[model samples]
Every structure is written in structure tokens, then in C-alpha cells.
Target: MERTLPKPKGIVIFGFLLPGILINLFIIVIPLILAIYFSLYKFTGGIMGDFVGLSNYAQLVKDGKFWNSFKNNLVITGLSIVGQLGFAFVLAIVLQSKWVKFREFHRTVIFLPVVLPAVVVGFVWTLMYNKDYGILNKLLSSIGLSSWIQPWLDDPGIVLYSVTAPIIWQFIGLYLIIFMSAIQNISSEIYEVAEIDGATGLRKAIYITLPMLADTIKVALMLCIAGNMKIFDNIFVMTGGGPGDSSTVMAQYAYNVSFGQFRLGYGSAVSIGMIILSLLLVLVIRRLMGGTNR
Candidate 1:
């Protein structure tokens, strides 16, 4: 079948887009320009000093702490891909099943965490992860698995993962909803055909659902990457990037440099580096995921 439609008018399109363009100009473009400008100078205490071009960038290149924080960001991004997306995939499938009871209620419960403040999640999980007199240890000891109970917030080796837990757990319902929405949008005729062809259960998921949901999965992965790379509040409330900086991620690290240490220029440089690294990593992932395909 052939289809025809009225062409969009240029004046009307521009009028519709003008507000968004102006907003981005102020919110994104101007700030980006200012960041670049500040990165070229030595600025501190709300004062701009000597313009040392590329020196801030040079110093950042030699900054071990910056690199360490970046490494932690990568770790979080990797874990989030598996933890959030993988868990959401399974949960969405379970909830979508015909035999499930009170599925709407379950979905509402799952999604509730998404609306909670990151600070609240952080504080709540911090108590949950406390080494002494905490719920985790009590449960483990009750199950006769006290050895499995960990110093979640204390140990440097595990603090990063501990802080990562609530961060990963918080938005899982969101990705689950995205996946479920995608799954629901799929045509029933396709499933009927799959049934006729003896596809069901795991076979149905693998052959019909997954392939059909590939685009949605890509979208979910992109959201996961962005969220993990830019995460701050919850981890800050939980760990403050500590246990000797073991839990430090790039965002919080830059913030500490900017505000805590008052090294505005250096912080700007770190922020720029984070922006670059995130773009590069996302682009690499997109390439690997065959992003150009429909």
C-alpha cells in the first residue's frame, strides 16, 4: 500500500521547535561554553584567575583520583547493565504471565521505588547495610549463614558494590515498565502465529519476544548507561565516596572537587573528562549494539 500526507510547513515546524531551541541554548549550550571557558583558567572561590590554556586538562590527565573515580563509574555502568536491565527483563516477563495474581498491585509496588528520593533510598539502605545491629546480618545469622553477612558500608573492598546496590535497585521498576510496555505493544497476531508454530515459554521469549524487543532493549541499555554514568545523590548519602575513596564515582568526585575542595577549574576539567568518557563509552556500546540498524 502507498500512503500520502501533507508536508510539514517549515514556518510551523520552526515555531513549534523555537521554545525547545531557546531552552537548550540557555540550559545546555551556554553552560557548556562556560565550562570550557572556565577549564582554560585557574578559578577558585568564585573568582577567575590567570588563563592557563590546556593546563587544567594537563593536570587532569595526571590526576590519579580522577581516573580512579572514572574507573568506578565504569564498574557501576557495567554492573547496572547486568543488574538493572537483566533483573528488569526477568521481572517484567514474570509479571506479564497469565497466572500472575494482583499483577497491577505488584507493578505499582515495584515502581514505587522509582519515585522515591535518592537521598531517602541511600539513608534507608545505609541502615540495611550496617555491619553491626543491621537487618542483613540478623537475617543471615537467622538462616545460619552469618559468614555470608558482610561489612557492607565499612570494608573498602566491598563498599563500592554496597553503595551500588540501592542505586541499582531503585530504578529497576522503571526499566521493567519500559520492557513490559514494549512487550505489550507487540501484536497478538505474532504470538498466535508463534503458538501455531509450537513456540511457547522460554522458546516463545527467545524466538518471538526478545527479537521483537531488541529496539526497546537498546533504549533500556542507553538509559541504564546514562543513569549510571550520571548517578550522584544516593551514593553520596550512603558512602560519601569513601572507605578510602573506594566508592568514588566521577560525578561525586567532580562535585567534591568543585565544592568540597573549591578547586573550580580542576573540577570543571574533571567534569569535561567525564562528559567525554561517557560519550565515548556510549558510542562504543552503540556500535557494538548495531545502533544503525532499524
Candidate 2:
């Protein structure tokens, strides 16, 4: 008698995938739905209160803090893109040249910051920026430029820019690696041909490298924008969103609203608004990139 082996059933296949799907729904989807629901009501002591019906959103429009936080995010995003991508691109090109010596050592030193923990970087920089006993002030004093030293984290006017420094310093290595790898994948023959045709230096970069690097640059820009949008750890560690919330970004503002001041409903609305804004901005940016596509 011939015996046939049992076949795997559709139920078994679904059973194998069900756990992950359910867990994702439980962890991500449920909270998202709850946030949207809570955005419509005023959260009270241990419970949601009467329906607010977009009052929270209206409050967002009228709130000066909300607008300030948004403006800070834009400034941070713009400056971050320029700082990170500009340095990374230059480093990638320079380091790729045969004339550069100890290339591996330079790469290691530069990329070292990328591997360091963000929390540690933040705290270290915070200490370095301390006005009374900080290295920064000490250096200025030694050079007889003592008047140049200001309370880095305490000053409202320049604190936001100061907060951005560590962020820009830390991420350049990551984008450098990415841009370098993209540069490498472009066949060497094209570059050689360009050189033979008297196209070198900035001509080769502007006409050849830039056109070929369109996609990679777009990815880098998107990552930079998204990261700046959700930035928290460094600012939180250094400033605690303080100096009168001068350095507050959207994420920090959401946390302060939700937990610090106990305004859960308004916080949820802010979060929802942030998500919508992020999505819209990304779409707009991506569309712009497409229009300039080579």
C-alpha cells in the first residue's frame, strides 16, 4: 500500500504569521487608535472627559509655544541637512582620493563618534558647555576672550544653536559612509573619461557625481529630516527642553504637554498633528526631489 505524506494546510500557514500580526496591532495600531480617540476628548483624572471636538487642535493654532516648537524644528531640520550632508559629501570625496594618507585611520577616527552612545555624547557636551567650570569657558578665558563665553545651555538666544552642535557633530560620520559607498559604486571608467575630456574637479563633481548621486542624496535628506523631527535624547539630556523651552522641538513639546503638565488630550492632539505634518512634509520633499530628478 502506498502512503502519502500530509500536506501543510492554509490554517498552518496563517497560524505561523498570526502572532506577529496580532502583536504589531496590539503594540502599534491600538495605541494609535487610542491617541486619535483621545485627541477628540479631554483627558481627566484616570479617565477621558467630555468630548472636546478639535478644541485641542484649535488650541494648537493659538498656542505660541506650539508655533515656537514648530519653527525650531524647521530651523533644526534645515541646518542639520546642510551641516550633515555638506560635511559628509566633502569628507567622502576627499577620503576617496589616493593622495590622502592613512585613509583607514582617518575613517576610523571620524566614524568613531557614530558608534558612541547618544546619551553619553549629550551628557559629555552638557558638561563641556557648563559656564562656570566648563572647558569651553576655560578656553575662552585662557585666550583673553573671556567676554566671548556665555552660558551655553542657559542663554535663550543661542541655546538652540548650541543644542544643534552635538547633533551635527555626531551624525556626519554615518552619512559620510553612505555617501562614500554611493560614490564608490559609480564605475571608475566614467570618471577617467571625464578627466580625459578636461572635465575635472568641480566640473566632474557638479556634472557627473551630483547627477549620479540623486537617489542616495534624497535618502540622506529624508533620513536627516525624519531624525530632526523626532530628536529628543540630546536636547532632553542637555537642556531638559528649558531656558523657557527655547530649545523645545515637537517630540519634547509633546512629552511636556502630555506628562509634565498633565494635559493628555491636548498632547495626543499635538502628537496626531505632528504625525500628519511629518507625513505631509516628507511627501512634499520627496515630490520636490522627483521634480529635480536626473
Candidate 3:
């Protein structure tokens, strides 16, 4: 007779998931519901006012500042895709190469920034971008390229990109580690076979390693989309959407509207707008990537 294993009891499974369920209910579900409910009213002065029925959202549609911030968010997201994911992929490939030495050291150094507090990274980069005495301008001066120096944080034209740079630098290591792990899981025999067939490393990476990493790449792209959509702390600490709202993102705008201007109803609407937009973008990405996590 063949041996059989017993299935877990429903109560046991529910017991195991109880803490997570409760946490989500209190932390995420409840807040989201309240935000939606509050969004339907003219909530202000710490009291829910008369129902406005999407008037706040209607105003948000015409709000120039909100759209400007959304555009800035798009720019940051695009740059993040190119900078963070792109560089991480390249670094992962290089580190996986047999010719590279001190792989562990390189990994550690690259990932060190990811573990640092976001506020700390922001402050450090802000200091580095200081035009008067900052290291960036000083380095340019030292290299006889002083013209390259600009008011990095103060200039509206370049402030967005300036804030974006530190964010990219801080997070590259995370995706680098992710890709490296995915690459490691690719079988050695596949590469060996490609090598035996006189295929070059580049060809093997393109044809074999890349195809094998399809699912992992999809996951990475999704993560990038979601994370960049709501990016806040780094830009907040660095510029506070400064130089007259040049680098403001959706999250920061919602914050300013809620706390800065004391417009809780509109702020809740903005918050809901962010959630809807993020979900829609994620859905589009999923569809474009073939709509399967497999």
C-alpha cells in the first residue's frame, strides 16, 4: 500500500494566516476604505463635512499643480526604468562573468546603499549636489570642467533629474542582487552547451540566459513600476518638491494638499487617484508582458 499524507485542517490554516489578515485589515484595508469614504465629502477642520459627490475629483482633473506633479512622476518612472533596472541588469551580467574578481566584495559595496536609511541617503546626496561647496562642483572645478556645475537642487530645469539620480543610485543594488540571483539559477550546462557549439558569451546571454529569465524580468519590471509610482521620501528629503514644485510627485502633492493646505477631502481624492493610476499602470504592464506570472 502507498503511504498518504493528511491535508492541513482549515482552522489550522486560518490560525496561521490570522495575524497577517488582521494586520492587513487594520493597516491597509481600513485606511483605504476610510480614504474612499472621506473622499466623497468636504472633509476639513478635523470634521467630515457635507457630501460633495466627486466634485473634489472634478477639480483635481483641472488642477494644474497635480498634473504637473504627475508629469514629473512619469519622468522619474521612465528614468528609473532606464537607470535602476538597466544598470542593475548590466552589473548583474558583469558580476556573473567568470573573469570578474572579488565578486562578493563588489556585491557588498553595491548593496550597502540599499540598506541605508532613505532620509540619510537623501541628505548626503543633497550635500553632494551643493553648488557652492559640494563635492560635485568641486570635482568639476578640479577637473577643469567648472562650467558643468549648476544649481543642482535650485534650478527647476534640472532639479527633477538631480533628485532622481540619488534615488537611482540608492536602489540599483537591490535589483542587481535580484538579477544576480536569477542569473545564478540558470543551469551551467546550458551555457556549456552553447559554448561547445561555438556560440559567443553575448549570443548565449541573448538567446539562452535572457529567455530563461523572462519571468524574473517581468517580476522586476512590475516591482519597478509599483515602487517608482509612489516614490516620496528620497525626493522629499532632498528637495521637498522644491524650486517651485519642479520635482513634486503624486505622493508629495497629496501630502502637501492634506497637511500643508489642510484640504483633507481633496487630499483623500488625490490619494485615491494615485491608487487607481498605479493599479492601471500595473495592469497595462502585465498585459504587455503577456498577463502571466508563470
Which runs in model 2 stand beyond 4 Å of their true positions?
A: 1-27, 291-294
State the C-alpha lDDT per candidate.
0.89, 0.89, 0.92
- TM-score of each prediction: 0.92, 0.88, 0.95
TM-score-best of 2 and 3: 3
Model 3 quality (TM-score): 0.95
Summarize candidate 3's per-residue lDDT along 147-243 as a digit string, tens digits.
Answer: 8989999999999999999889998999999999999999899899899999897897789877888898888888888999999999889999998
User: Per-residue lDDT tens digits of candidate 1, residues 1-294?
Assistant: 878988999999999999999999999999988888888888885568999999999999998998999899988889989999988988988898899999999999999999999999999998988878789888999999988999898898988888888978998999999999989999989888988998877888888888889989998898899889988998899889998789899999999999998888888988899999899988999899998355
- Candidate 3 runs further than 4 Å off: 1-6
Question: Model 1: clashing residue pairs?
Answer: none
| Cα error, candidate 2, residue 193 (Å) | 1.1
> Candidate 2 residues 1-294, lDDT tens each?
999989989999899999999999999899999999998899944866989898999998788897788888888888899999999988988898878999889888889898998899999999999999999999999999989999999999999999999999999999999998999999999999999999967787889888798889999998998888888889989998879979998889999999999989999998888887777788899998783444
Give the per-residue Cα lDDT of candidate 1 at 285: 94
Q: Where does candidate 1 have its weakest 10-residue lDDT segment?
A: 39-48
Off by over 4 Å in 1: 1-19, 292-294
Kindly give the stretch of ten consecutive residues in candidate 2 with the minimal lDDT sum.
285-294
Best by TM-score, which number?
3
